[model samples]
Target: MCENNPVRFIDAFVDGLDLDALGFKRVKPKATGRPGYDPSDMLKLYIYGYLNRVRSSRRLEAETHRNLEVIWLMRQLKPDFKTIADFRKANRTAFREVFRSFVRLCRELDLYGRELLAVDGTRIKAVNNKDRNFTKASLKRDLARLDERLERYLKDMSEADTRDDDGPGGDASAKKLTEKIETMKARRERLAGYQKTLEETGEDQLSLTDPDARAMERNTRVGVGYNIQIAVDAKHKLIAEQQVHNKVSDLGLLTETADAARKTLGVETLDVVADKGYFVIEDVEACEAAGAIPFVPKPQRGSAASKGFFVKDRFRYDAKANHYTCPGGQELTQQGGKRVVRKGVHVIGYQNRRACKNCPLKASCTDAAFRKVTRYEREEVLDRMAERLADRPEILDARRETVEHPFGSIKQWMGQGAFLMKRLDNVRGEFSLTALAYNIRRAITLVGIPTLIDAARA
Candidate 1:
């Protein structure tokens, strides 16, 4: 198998194509500092490493020396670990372009379906731990602890000053206590400085290891990590776009992911589907505005289900009358036109306070004075999507099958906390490489490696 390894396609794909064309900066080094390795060669080495799951820089350096397939791929030029690492840092942007290049290549090969797309986010563990991540509350607790410790130190010094007789240990002990007090004071100052840094940056969370990492909750487990969002095409299951976000919520991510898929597919419109997590009203409006139809299931918000009262879905809207009819026979009329509910969000309130006061359903409807149904400014857009979903509810099933495939496959490549790079930017580069490797693996699996190489050659 080593004699005729299919990974040779990776070599042919990297070398035959123009690296500079793919945005990798080519080096034309003069007589200086032991002539740098060509950027393309280093890129080849990384592609090979990622495909084989040998992601460590030091291990890649070892492979250049020993592994026969790698030797053949890199042409016996054994650049050390530092050199290999430097190539990744220097050409981080190139990795992204390379990912796009493969996407375009797949498009040329008719691998991208360009029709149905599923947008989703998966949490990839960051190098930082929960202990390293600091929230404002956590910082306040630390400061409190420091305050107590400082008080304890001051108490010891006060007792020493009043005691008048140094028992057992003598005057040298008092001198040691003075040194310890100074040390404790300095330590308290350092904690205060850290607190100031947190306040100055206005960051809700801080990580000592990976500063960009956040304490994100995904499903059941919470950890210091990044929310990696990707839009996967339904046909060949190629990733259309990959984005790294520190924000934990998938609420408003649908539009951005959908629009990105539209751009990558180079299509005028897209048909997107996601889970209830991405069912933001604004995202649905943006998608429809861009000619893309999103089929996200509207999230079940409010306590109506638990309270046995009428749910939002139970009420019917009258477009002509511009009002809502409750489960009870009462009209909920608009209180105002488009109004700012919060920053960047708008709502129109609907209430029939007089009708509610006299109605029999008032007790079930609200614990408040009356029932107020607030409609978002773009509720019409959501109404359109709801109509779309009622027509094709099976699209949700299609989304589950299409998008989750790539995520499950890629997660197998990343073990527990398996980001090999440190900073957010470097991890982005590393993930780009992972996405490229996955695309290659997908292409080879769909068509043979020989056919893939032949396609690249053409």
Candidate 2:
């Protein structure tokens, strides 16, 4: 190996870690049976494979025999693909600690700014195929089609029987139609069972290959996958924290992701920024409570926005007066009969019917007798976040730049567009290694390999 080879850094970095302390299995090795490969060697191999875009255990096994760098890193110990694969499956949870260890190393090297973190999520295709996944709507549609086909087959069988030819061709046609009806009936039974299971469990979708995977939209196309969230530091665009969840949307995930990054960065309070997908008020409040300042743009989603009417944001609320000033300068106080509970949230409606009766802006405001603007009890949290976002509009742009780099690199540059693992746990482990590899490559570029090796030794 050359003097500045990244292999040297990988070897040193893995050797310096206490694998047993990091929850790796078989770190001490058995004294009775045939000697096992050291956990450090296995970890080093995985890190090297992921860094070089060779994620499969079989590929790493091949590399040990063919790739000179792998030979040097493994010291000529050829572990088969099964052994290499078993090591990862057994130590799935421990990979996260190793990732965090490297994050700490980056912190020590001053690679993280620790002042700002950009949180975002991307959908990675799971091992399950789209056909193996079933949703309520999909099942209903399939069953309806099956019924239609079954009815058609029965009608054809009836017509064949009515011909009364008693010849060989007619009998064969009837038998084939019968077989098709039976097959369709069996399929209907299975789909009905899936519908029943969904009804019992109240889950929206079920995946046959990987039960934990969900059908989610990625770039406006639906696929079976897991949501992968990451928090990237603003300085070098390095990933501070990464997590895998089966959730379908990014609505309430901001606080958890940002808080984890704040702890990893070892900061008292960190600035967190994300896109409008994470504009849930409860999550923003929780992020604030966790000591992370969140800046998420309020999503323009309302019936008013869709109907070309004056949206709720156009009406300003007066804190002292506890009333809303509409676009027509009419005071909309809390009406008597408009209090309602929506989605377990107590919302109060405000409307001044007399003002709307003759107001000039009523044409654009509402076409009804009066326009009622409803507010949730805890909407003040959203108000505060809106104020914060108005002040630092550039942070949203910073978030786009900082977070998109890691995801783009992982999907395009790292060749991790789809996961090779089966379940959520395995994919989480896979992504931990992928993220670790990304950070390693980034850190190597920012501050050379020698600096990382020294930090690992210390």
Question: Which candidate number maximizes TM-score?
Answer: 2
Residue pairs whose backbone atoms clash in candidate 1? none
Off by over 4 Å in 1: 1-4, 27-34, 142-191, 302-309, 342-344, 414-416
Local error of candidate 2 at residue 372 (angstroms): 1.6
Candidate 1 residue-wise lDDT, 1-458, digit = tens: 34236667877677676777777764433336666678878888999998888888899999988898899888888887877877888888779888877787788788989998888998898888788887888778887887887788788878878987567886888788788878877867866776788889988887889988888888888888888888889997889888777888887887876787688678898798889999877777778788668898887787765676677887788989999999788889998678886677898889888988888877788777888887887688888889999999899889989877788888875442458777888888988988888888898888778777777777
lDDT values for all models = 0.81, 0.91
Supply candidate 1's per-residue lDDT for 438: 83
- Displacement of residue 39 (Cα, Å) in model 2 is 1.6
Candidate 2 lDDT trough over 10 residues, lowest sum: 26-35
Total clashes for model 1: 0
By lDDT, who's the top model here? 2
The window of 10 residues in a row where model 1 has the poorest summed lDDT is 26-35
